[model samples]
Target: MGLINMATYLDIIRGTYEGTSEENGKRLRDALATDAVWTEAAGFPYAGTYVGPEAILANVFHRLATEWIDYRATVHTYVADGDRVAAFGTYSGTYRTTGKTMEASFAHLYRLENGKIVNMQQFVDSAMVRAAMD
Candidate 1:
């Protein structure tokens, strides 16, 4: 019984940040609840509240792919509290336009329901990301 593959909040959330950008994106969309809300931090390049997987894929995933070269989120730690999970990590990449590189710390919070992410919030130092673009 204990061996059952019950997915924890952190496991569901880790799917969103584990693989390559494209692969991780697929996992993210797959783990999203029907009305999931994905919030990008204000001042972030893709800052906004995206409802549903489609919106998030279009606004955040697609833009990141096109605007940044080799962009990635590497999670160093994961903390789970009941239905909530927090991923502490770093973002690194080179801006397509500027060809400058950036490494910024990030924290992603997720609330899951029935093994799917119902809400998510992003926290990061936008200035560090902006420095690379400029």
Candidate 2:
């Protein structure tokens, strides 16, 4: 297993957020291994622990698409050390159900191994999101 560069990992994450094609999704899947785990801290509406790259692809990507018409994440700060990368960002989207727009700040800690994302934990402002939905 080779060490994955932090910048490259960030680029992959950025691409996943910005890319709108099926090819992009495929690229993300290629970047991540089959056993990758993604977890979100408690408090957010979608807060729960998810395991496996397939789950992330399904719940984080597919399920989100159902709730949001257009979603995008903008990175504010990113720091990497060893095999872990931490990113602070804002995620903005239009809710498909109400057509309401919302933006929330978020932080993510990612662990990489063998040039693939092995684990990810996300933290977001749930109160703000709940207020926006109200």
Per-model TM against the reference: 0.92, 0.83
| Candidate with maximal lDDT | 1
TM-score of 1: 0.92
Q: What TM-score does structure 2 among the candidates reach?
A: 0.83
| Number of the top TM-score candidate | 1
Superposition error at 84 for model 1 (Å)? 0.2
> Relative to the unseen true structure, what is the C-alpha lDDT of residue 102 in candidate 1, on a scale of 0 to 100?
97
List pairs with backbone clashes in candidate 2. Answer: none
lDDT of candidate model 1 versus the reference: 0.87
